[model samples]
Target chain A: MLHEPASQSGPDASADYKMRIGVWMFLLYAAIYAAFVAINLLKPLWMEKTVFLGLNLAVVFGFGLIVFALIEALIYNHMCGTHEADNKGGE
Target chain B: MAIAIFLTFVAAVLGLSFYFAAKTKSASGYFAAGGQIHWGVNGIAFAGDYLSAASFLGICGMIATAGYDGFLYSIGYLAGWIVALFVVAEPMKRLGKYTFTDALDAKFNSRGIKLFAAISTLVVSVFYLIPQMVGAGVLVEPLLGIPHYAGVIMVGAIVITIVATAGMTSTTYVQFIKGAMLVVFSLIVTVAVLVRGLSTEPDQGGRVPFYKYATLEAKEVKGALVVNDYKVLTSVPAKAETYVKLEKGGVQTWWLRSDKDGKIALKETQYEVKKADGSKLVNGLPASKDNVLRQNGGLEAIKGKTGPEAATGKVGPFEFLSILSDPETRINTWKIVKLSDGEDKVVVYAPSVKPGNKMMRPGLKFKTEGTPIQKLDFLSLMLALFLGTAALPHILIRYYTVPSPACARKSTIVAIAAIGFFYVLTMYMGLGAVINAALNPVTDNMSAPLLARTFGTFLFAVISAIAFATVLGTVSGLIIAASGAVAHDLMDRYLQLGHTEKQKVRAGKIAAFVVGIIAILLGILFQGMNVSFLVGLAFAVAASANLPSIIMILFWKKTTAKGIAASIVTGMVSAIGLIMFSPSMYDKFGLNPATAPVPLDNPGIISIPLSFLVLVAVSLLTQKKEASAA
Candidate 1:
């Protein structure tokens, strides 16, 4: 027989909403990351093209990904925190 | 001075550990910091825990040596944190009490889940710990002037004391301090690099300048010559390749012919040979202070510059990269070749000049024009890094330190911000090393610290100390995670040991000690081995073995305990097995790489999917039995 969970906590009212938003965002990021690998594989020389601010595509895209992730993480935290606060008040 | 700074860092870390030890009496406190860590502190600590020596030294060294290929690791590593935040962070906080195994077995609570998860945790932690320990040894040599084994033992002893004394509480604070210092210092280094800017002939500060090359007509070249009391044996092979082997009083070096309009132009190469008799030679001389390999690597020329003194001072971040990306700019990069000469192993370090535009792009190490297998290896490595961060036991357990899911999410954002900013700095630090004549051509791992030295010895000392702290913080986390797997999951939960809280804590301390010693031994044993590959292997294993089970358990209702257990074992075994038989390992074993059975060095593309398949198939097969039993 399976043992019970070690501690009992109340159900998270915001779990489903968070899950929906989180999965969608994860998929979006995954697609973008996949494109990075694909481009490096298919047309590696294209990374040399100066696409932004005189930096090559490689430097621009690589920096963009890191900055983009930070922004996405902050946005996710804000949305999740707000949703949690709303759910707690309603409950 | 570096030793003094390093000792001070160690003392502060120990003081913090002992301070926390007094308050950490219970299992909860020892294991999870009593779940009271502020989200902001926990967030920076997360960055500390995640950015191991591999991320700092290895990636920077890679960028310094290989250019754009090195940045790929930074991109993949940071991207993995997204998976952690968006998918794993909140759910993990809600489920786990002490360890990640607690979360995996939360719903089922099966002994099987506990056993496999604990084993997987231990394996991954140990695999990760070895590299950090080895890196500690490597850093200590330059910083503290100690032998490699002493450095490994020093780190092992300190980390063990920290984990044994206060466990996760001490580990978190160490990581937090380390994370903040690393980011701030890296930013400073980046600023210094920008201020120094691009120069064709960088001021080497009285150090050895770049080595010069010589050219001769093919017909003018004699079979042998004696220059400066050194015997030079020239060989002109049928394949139009010309090379010269130089020997001076039993010392050996090699120079390879370079392309110069069909002329026989020979580029100098520094070589170290270890004869079977155990004697060593450096650059055709005995291995000593005066016979050391000359430091090389700097801008051959900057775009639109007519003379060596031309400089681009105080360039902006974009302008720095832009100047480097210019077609006319050229920089020096080294290519390594290993050969055996009559039972003596010779490693030749040769420098090649490439256009800055080419170096700023992705083809140097990843081999965009290489074989299909090479491309697959690159893809697999990126995939593993992307999936591995969320699955690492050390990274996952940080969730339990936070009080709420919201804090966990908040802290994750903090970590991403701090870590992302540091990665950006790494690019500058790496490029700075390339153009500053700061590379230790033999050990690229010294790039960042050496770059610091180019500024001043004091900065070098401080950077090296923080780097050592970086290793200490990471090792403490890994050891604590491993101890948790042993004390909490394996001994207490899986075996039903029924130990009291104090006994469990004692058991954890003992486990930490044992793991620390084991890590130290392994670190010493593998002293001169390349550490980057070990880190890559750990990531591949973590992604392959742990991620599929994690994703399935959280998302799929049909994920039975049997499926989870099977998936974890399958993933772990398959990934490790593939790596062991991969081309790289074969080369390590002194066998021909082409003869290796596994085509791909990284097993993520195969083992990850294979693990998912095993979980699905096993879950389907066991679903009926599980339902009937319930």
Candidate 2:
């Protein structure tokens, strides 16, 4: 027997669309994150090179990834929200 | 005053838990907070739950001691939330009822899936709990002046009460409070750091100023170097680069050999030794106030600035990083050398001067130019942190507390933003500790708290209480997850014990009590082990055992029950097995690390991929059999 969901809410009508957007976003972020590890591994000295505001590539890139994730999350939420609103009535 | 504040915080948390207990009558209320938590509250709570003692204390301590290498953890950890927000959050909300096992086994009611997933949850939770519990004990001794075991028991009992009384409801609120307080107070500390700016001589609150090394001309008489009428007992031939050990007045200390303009000079170092007789000696003298390793860490000079009182007072965030990146600026960092002096253990806290440009870069703790295996170890750790956050049982279970998939997604975004902001502040807090003479030579875990003490006693008390709350929040969340695995997944579903709602809630409470006790014992048993290392192991285990099955099941249509079950077992066993014999564990076991079979300390690089391959193979093999049966 299939176990029921804990919440009483019905199945989401926009789940497929949301999943499509989510997968794309996941791939994009994973690539960016992978490049960070790759750069540290392959070109270690490159991190020491001064980049922005007298900070090295290591500090700048590290801070950039964190900020980028937040901006991407907000954008993802907004895109999904707009799509859900345009297609199905907002949840 | 700190004790009073801590007691007040504890009382407030207990009161909140008992208040929620009256409303948490059913199993749903106990397990998932009745799916009624507001997205905003749940979002902050997620941050609180996720930022355990490891993130707040361990990472800050690492950065304080090791520089930019520690921030790698903050980056990797926050990166993992991208996976949570974009992939796991919504589906988890839609599928899972109580625990992570609920989501994994939802598609297939196979007893194998239930049993294995529950086991994985419990294993991951228990491993994760050990570090947080140990960190609690570690924090308490310095902050509250209590014994370590007593601190561990106090945290265990309080967390058990919080979980058993109201389960997710109380845990969520506790996490929410902690998360908010942690962020706000860290921001205050960061602002304090920025306002104070860079200083060559930081005020040390009337304590003895940092020990300055004495430079003396190297004079050798009768094959022994003598300084201040004291005989050097062991001289290693004043080479251009080597430290020489000397004894005077029953105290032994190391002196650096420096050759400048064809003139040799010897510089004194601070060293501590623990003798076989259980007596401690500092600077070759019996441990006393007059002779000890003075507070370490400060800037030797600032760029384009002159004089001993040179300071970059009140700089912006960008300027702070910029000033530290100057080529002429030098920061004092301590390097610890552990050696055996006969039957006694000698630990030398040697001061090393590094250019600010190099200090802010990688290679302090994780050597980029190290061996290929060492490089791979860094990769494995990054991969684990990148993939581990979404797979963690306590984190996954939070998705169910929200009402809808959208709420789950929104809450995750909120978590990412709040946690990211706090992580950004960790850089400042760590750098603050590094340049402000705030590090405790004994433990790096106390760096953040000690940095707060540099600001004032009030901020220190508040930060310590919040850090303690951080441990309590995370431990309660882990216990709730583990309890749900046992009471809801194992007992009710896998074994089909057919417990009523009340019985199920009671069982969960009992499980929480037992797990809390186990955590306490492990915490006390594993004292002095690296907290960050234990946390990294948890991340590796979670990423290995859970992520493969989770991603495959959600994305792949051909995933079979056998695939999920086999994948979970393979991933869990492989990760645990590798860790058991890994070089780090070998060192922990008091054996030579080089003799260990596993080269990689983190199992995620190998075991995660292995799990995915096993799942695909098992699924392909069982597809035809399952098709025929259906």
Following a full C-alpha superposition, what root-mean-square deviation does model 1 have from the true structure? Answer: 2.5
Structural similarity to truth (TM-score) of each candidate: 0.95, 0.96
lDDT of each candidate versus the true structure: 0.86, 0.88
lDDT for each residue of candidate 1 in B428-478, tens digit (9 for 90 to 100): 998899888788877777788888888887899989998899999999999
How would the docking of model 2 be graded? medium
Q: Model 1, residue B249: displacement in angstroms?
A: 10
For model 2, fnat equals 0.75
Error of 1 at B198 (Å): 1.6
When summed lDDT is taken over every stretch of 10 residues in candidate 2 chain B, the lowest stretch is B232-241
Docking class of 1: medium
Best by DockQ: 2
Q: Could you list the CA RMSD of all candidates, in the order they appear?
A: 2.5, 2.3
